[model samples]
Target: MDLDALVGRARSLAGGGATRTVLGLAGPPGAGKSTLAQTLTAALGDAAAYVPLDGFHLSNAQLDRLGLRSRKGSEPSFDVRGYEALLRRLVGEPAREAYVPDFDRSLDEPVAARHLVPAGARLLVTEGNYLACDLPGWREARGLMAEVWYVDAAADLRDARLMRRHTGFGRDEAAARAWIDGNDRPNAELVERSRDRCDLVVTSLAG
Candidate 1:
């Protein structure tokens, strides 16, 4: 679907007495969830705000302590409960502004309160891999969203994009490939299994 169509549907969910209408974009790694979230937020102007669940990525230190640093992007490496609480605040307290953390890919860490959702924003866009997962916190997160869209792409294309991202963020070519093959691909498979749970399935998003 076109950007306008997506915006229209999101807008429709925000009218009348609604407090905050959340449009969830769920997908496997490299499926363009971040791209769609940014595009929709920009297209919707001040009416929309973005809160990525990636912002809740556990710190590298915490990951090391948990012995999960090698599998950083996996679901267990995130602060799922924290992300869920932030979602609740977005929909529950419409009259108050919410400060949201942002994930810095360059630093591979989460920066606190880097983005804010103003009280006037009618729509909130949240994107992540686990939004539609049937796992504990994810199922509750899915229930919190007004609508969920599953972003998808061909496997080869997705793998290529992920490799580029990993290298750009600092890994060497071989390390990036190993991480993608061993860690990311498994997480992608887990995410894809929940595709049918989303309200819509979007194969490709425009540049």
Candidate 2:
């Protein structure tokens, strides 16, 4: 579907004049989920807010302590319970502003409370790789959302985007490819399995 159609769907879920509504964007890494989430928030203006799940990644120190530095982006490396709690607060306490974390790619770390969802924000767009996951904390997190849209693109395109992302973030070309093949490809496969769980499968947002 196109941008207008996606926006229309989100608007309906927002319920116009009712309580806060959350729209989740789930897809594998490099699937353009963040791009779509940001675009929707820009289109909807103040009525909407974007809160990304990557913001809940565990600290590098924590990863090192847990001996998971080599598998940095794996599900076990994230603060899934913390993410669930944030969603709960957002859904249950609509009258208050909630502070959400944001991941800083440059530092490869999470910056605390960098994103604020104002009480007036009726639509919250949260994008990430694991929103549709059936794991303990992840399943409950998905249940909290009003709806989840799974963004998708050609496999080659996703691979290209991921290669550029890793290289841009500091890895050399060889390392980038290696990481994608060894670490990210497996995660992508797992995310692909969760596509059936999403409310919508967004193939494109070209309109």
State which candidate has the highest TM-score: 1
**Tens-digit lDDT track for model 1 on 48-125?**
999999899999999999999999989999999999888987898988898999899988899999999988898899
Q: Please list the C-alpha lDDT of all candidates, in the order they appear.
A: 0.90, 0.88
Model 2 residue 195 CA deviation (Å) reads 0.9
Q: Write candidate 2's Cα lDDT for 59-88 as tens digits.
A: 999999999888888888889889888888
Per-candidate RMSD, Å:
1.2, 1.6
Model 1: CA > 4 A from native = none
Worst 10 residues of 1 by lDDT: 10-19
lDDT of 1 at 190: 97
